[model samples]
Target: MENSTQINTEKINFSLEDLEQDIWVRLVTGAVKSRNPFHTPCVATMDKGEISLRTVVLRKALAKERELRFHTDIRSPKWKELSLNPSISALFYDAGDRIQLRVKGKAVLHYKNDLTAEAWKNTTSSSRRCYLTLHSPSSFAEIPTSGLSEEIEQENFTLAESEMGYSNFGIVSIQVHSIDWLWLNHAGHRRAFFDYTDGSFQWMIP
Candidate 1:
């Protein structure tokens, strides 16, 4: 779920590497990057004074790059919104650990780029083919179209429609401006933020 970035404007700063690392622990302990594929951070935007968030998967962990990324269909509603307003927030929680993290930043979209294509190529044909079925993600239909339904050839459809769908397959990169982390430990609850926009971090009262 990582996207490549060409312009290096800013890198997100964390208050402390240990706490930041601990948050990662909370994520792993909660199987955040694994089974929680759909537990992706909710990207929110202020749509005419109201807020809306959508589920998105964290596809890649570019820690070294100091970045976080996710993947979604380019035609998805969230994608279109981001296209209009790059500023967005990603929210995640680990129920077992009683921890949550929110990152706010500008979003960039990558589709069919060298890196994106590489990831797409590495994906399983079964999953890769799913993108071929439709252009509009989250679009509703009167009925479901399963690979096993209608005695139709799913593989053939994917292969035949690959080009058309590939254009819409995209990865989203969050240009993290700040990260607000809330964690509960043996001592007490702690909330802190790493603000890259100002190049400083502070621990906040939780």
Candidate 2:
């Protein structure tokens, strides 16, 4: 549910420019508000001739640069897959607002770099705990486990202890190329496409 501070930006009278700005507004909101539907988006990538999809938290959105950022474990398959094929897509939807956004881009990984260093410095110990795993994300286990060590699983590690996970932490920056936006309503639906690569935008039949 939207908070009291949320404004009504999905009205039918909205223009293309308004819709584009609203999309960024919602993305920025999702990054800070866990309750927002856009907080988690379905990210798709090409992996060895196959399509891989996963839900990722929206860490940052830069409207001017046409980029979206996410954090990941350097050992994760998604990281390696993206390294092999940078082509990626992201899907976001808000049922309450009846809006959908399909974003296409290329993924750029940052590991042990200044970008990752700054991001790690601002990360909380709890969030950093995700990188303290004993095995890779999809590694097979003899028994069910959280992939994290008992100490990390129990959240007994101190802030300094969490620093060990920083090496496994990495950033995935999506250099957005285009966006397909759709709005559903009882009266009628609206759709539009915006391409940053060529600076082309147009309304489409919904």
Candidate 2, run of 10 with poorest lDDT = 1-10
RMSD of each: 7.5, 2.2
Candidate 2 lDDT score relative to the true structure? 0.87
TM-score for all models, in order of appearance: 0.75, 0.93
Report the alpha-carbon TM-score of model 2 versus the true structure. Answer: 0.93
Which stretch of 10 consecutive residues in model 1 shows the poorest summed lDDT?
A: 1-10
Q: Report the lDDT of model 2 for residue 14.
A: 63
Q: Rate the local accuracy (lDDT) of all candidates.
A: 0.65, 0.87
Per-residue alpha-carbon lDDT of candidate 2 for residues 61-104, written as tens digits (9 for 90 to 100): 88888889999998999999999999999999998888899999
lDDT of 1 by residue, 63-121 (tens): 44556677677777777788877888878876655567887888888877887988777
Best by TM-score: 2
